[model samples]
Target: MLYKLNLEHILFLDIETVPQKQHFTELDEDVQALWEQKTQYQRKDEFTPEEFYDRAGIWAEFGKIVCISVGYFAPKGDQRNFRVTSFYGEEIKILKDFKQLLADHFSQAKHLLCAHNGKEFDFPYIARRMVINGINLPYKLDLFGKKPWEVPHLDTMELWKFGDYKHFTSLKLLALVLGIPSPKEDMDGSMVKDVFYIENDLDRIVTYCELDVVTTAQVFLKMRNEELLADDEIKKV
Candidate 1:
């Protein structure tokens, strides 16, 4: 059934986020107390709230999306060209630009958004960030009253689960097992915060995010038993 679906109708995407502030000390007193309380269970006796700040990017309330890279397949005569692009820079601007893209191009009912672990993370994180930024949710991201089957969203991780609810697979592990080329050669999710705050290399982070998009697409193609995308077919825009 996945193979029967049009590749052009799906958008594969990945996002990179970092703590709202460069450091824990940057947050005001009241917010610091809030952070301490929010992460208490996770921190436990191993680490203090301030010590766990680096992981705050996993939470929409304390994190900000710095980049969102998306890739879509476009039919090219006898072949398919996978084009990738990114929206980065100021968080509000990035959200606005991405919102415009969805409204202008992917508003149709047939269009679907795909990512690894998207249902649990990427999709909701983007939606929450959009609300926090006061941007209207695009049709694809808005799920107020849509039925389960009516939702136009896909998750490579969910597909891989195949009904095993307790199973958890990281994108890197999935790609490795599926024989798809590794996308973490340069950097990975763990190093994103330092790269953004210390190295100030957003371009690097963008490249990393785009690679994950490509990898997610490849994973979907693998699931459909389709040919993998060749290097020449992937174009960064």
Candidate 2:
């Protein structure tokens, strides 16, 4: 059962990213050439303008991390309640704070870092940015050389597969299907970078990250047979 484990051992997290814009132009010749060569063919067809920008290292210019939010389920009375928190700041500061928080509160718990589609985007991005900032990673999150099935992670997207893993759905759509209200107020994932970079509205990015985290927590709750809160019960972060 999904709820068989203690609540204290589950940590739900999500991150928002905007590719670096400035740094890519400054990539030394060899690196720049390699990047171009790697993306040359693929960029012509399969990539969206936004994806192209990210693959081109535009997010690196924004310092890699735009915002990161985390939620945890802890015992409360006969039921478990959830707590959520997020940080929006310079990439290094936010990543450092994230590291400290994990070390202080979750260093020893046999916790599973849960997210939707995190294995593909959030996990590697966090690990890369952490290394670039010289921060070591926690053991459960060390993704190097591990097969997908070997990782101690619980991606809602993967779980939704029921082993067929077909017909992947968006987080918003999945949450809606599960009767969880959409957490995003007026923005979408495609607009995250634009909102953060063009509008300079860091709060929106943080909010988006928080939304994903909470929605992900709700997914876990549903999977575990716990009673889900109504739309009115969701408090804005």
The candidate that achieves the highest lDDT relative to the unseen native structure: 1
Which digits, one per residue and each the tens of the lDDT, describe model 1 over residues 1-237? 797899999999999999999899999999899999999999998999899999999999999999999999987998889999999999999999998988888989999999999999999999999999998888898999999999999999999999999999999999999999885458889999999999999999999999999999999999999999999999988
- Angstrom error at residue 42, model 2: 3.3
Q: Please state every model's RMSD to the true fold in angstroms.
A: 0.9, 3.4
Alpha-carbon lDDT, every model: 0.94, 0.73
Which pairs of residues collide in candidate 2? 18-59, 19-58, 19-59, 20-58, 20-59, 20-60, 20-61
For model 2, where is the 10-residue window of minimal lDDT? 54-63
lDDT of 2 by residue, 18-56 (tens): 766534555566665666566667787776444465444
Kindly provide the TM-score of model 2 when superposed on the true structure, using C-alpha atoms: 0.83
